[model samples]
Target: MFTNLLAFHSIFRWLVLAALFATCILFVYKHFTNKILSLKDYRFLQVVCLILNIQFILGVLLFSKSQLALLFWDNFQETVKLRQPRFFGLEHPSMMILGILLFNCFTFKIRNKINTKEAFTYFSKRFILILIIILSSIPWSFSPLTHRPNYRSLELTNF
Candidate 1:
């Protein structure tokens, strides 16, 4: 079950990333082109928000079941000495939660704005902020502290 959840969480990240990128590009286009915000733009934001929420829930579940997370909780001092465990147990989750909070706050502020141009401008800035947060929080392959998963090794039969 844990492995299945882990695999799902890993694979789902692509969806979240794609949605975020799409939203960012759309916001950038709107801002530079002076295009009025459309219903499609609102829908795209909604989709990205929903994806982030789902990813957060999945991450929490995975964290609870992760042995690395358990070790960190059991012995913070010792766990922090190891980079991978520490990143998984604390840094990743903390930054992700922070990203989520920023995403929500920015989206809420954008929704409250009555002017289309004002909302577009607000979204452009906030989306870039959220994108940076998300990008930084990700455990990319080149990171010495963490490595990307091998999709081929994620066999369902192992679960």
Candidate 2:
């Protein structure tokens, strides 16, 4: 189950990135065009929220089941000394939660009856921040701090 969740987490990351990228692009276009956000735009934001929520849940589960997290809990000083364990156990989770919280700026952007320009400015800035946070912390295969495969198959490779 733990392995499966990890693989799923890896796979779902692509979906999360794609959704966020597309949403950010739309927000940027709207900002430059000075167009009032439409119902479709709002719905797309809702979808992005849904995707983020799902990814966050999966990440939480993986974090709970992770050996690195357990090790981090058991020996905070020791774990903090290493890079991979530290990345997976602490840096990744905290940064992701912060990014998710930053994503909630859109919630306010859509909910309040603020000026459309203000809304666009607020949301676009926070969304870009969220993107940067997530992109930075992600364990891409090329990352110098830590690295993981670009993809993980959800098959029972061990069994």
Candidate 3:
């Protein structure tokens, strides 16, 4: 079950990333090109918020069950001193929660139906900010510190 959660979390990241990029970059082509926000633009943002919300929930569950997190909690000071432990235990989760907050905040504003042009302007910038936060926090395989695979198999990382 833990391995299943790990795999799901790993695979789900792609969906989250793609949705983020589409909403912040691709779908907002109108805003970038000096056009107004279409109805679909609103939907795109909504979709990303939903995806991120679910992802955040999954992350919370995974974190609660993760051995690394347990070790970090039991050995706070020592674990924090190490790069990989610190990245996984503190940095990544915090940044991801921050991203979720930013995402929900923007979604709230849009759902309230503010001026279309102003909302588009706001969303484009806000979306980009959250995207950057999430992108930076992701532990890519190539990262020197706290790297993980593009996909997780049955075995979870011990580090």
Candidate 4:
């Protein structure tokens, strides 16, 4: 059960990352190009936000039961500052939550603005800030302490 959950989370990160990047780019484009915020724009944000919310919920369930929580409880702030603990326990979850907040804020602020352009402009900048936060928080294997089990992409080799 744990392994299956781990695999699901590992693969799901890619989708979350892709959606995050797309939303970031769209926001940037809107800022630079002064594009109008159409229904499509809001729809895109909604889709990505929904995915992120799910990912976050999954992570919470996984971490709360695992040894990771034990470690986090023991070390708290110090654990979160380090690579492995930070990634799994703090960075990934906090940044994702922060991203959700940004999206919600944008939706709230822009849903009924009389000046669509100004509302969009506000949203774009807010989006960029969240993107930066998310980018910093992703857990790549590059970190030395990333010791989650069974991350191999194996294949049969011919001798």
User: Which has the greatest lDDT?
Assistant: 2
TM-score for candidate 2, residues paired by index:
0.91
Error of 1 at 41 (Å): 1.5
TM-score-best of 1 and 2: 2
Better of 3 and 4 by TM-score: 3
Worst 10 residues of 3 by lDDT: 111-120
RMSD (CA, Å), candidate 2 to true, equals 2.0
Model 1 C-alpha lDDT per residue in residues 47-145, reported as the tens digit of each score: 788899999999999999999999998999888898888988998999899998888777766666534777887777766777788888788777665
Against the true structure, what is each candidate's TM-score? 0.90, 0.91, 0.88, 0.74
Lowest summed lDDT window (length 10), candidate 4: 150-159
Global lDDT scores for all candidate models: 0.81, 0.83, 0.81, 0.71
Model 3 regions more than 4 Å off: 113-115, 154-159
lDDT of 4 at 61: 77
TM-score of 4: 0.74
Worst 10 residues of 2 by lDDT: 108-117
Q: Return the clash pairs for model 3, or none.
A: none
Candidate 4 residue pairs in backbone clash: none
Encode model 4's per-residue lDDT on 49-124: one tens digit a residue. 7887788777877887667666876899677676666566666677768876777667766767533677676776
lDDT of 3 by residue, 1-159 (tens): 777888889999999988876765663566667766556666767788899999999899999998888888789988988787677678889999999999888787776554366777667777778878999999998988778999866554533
Question: Candidate 2 residues 82-152, lDDT tens each?
Answer: 99788888899999988887676566456563445566766777777788999998999998879999998
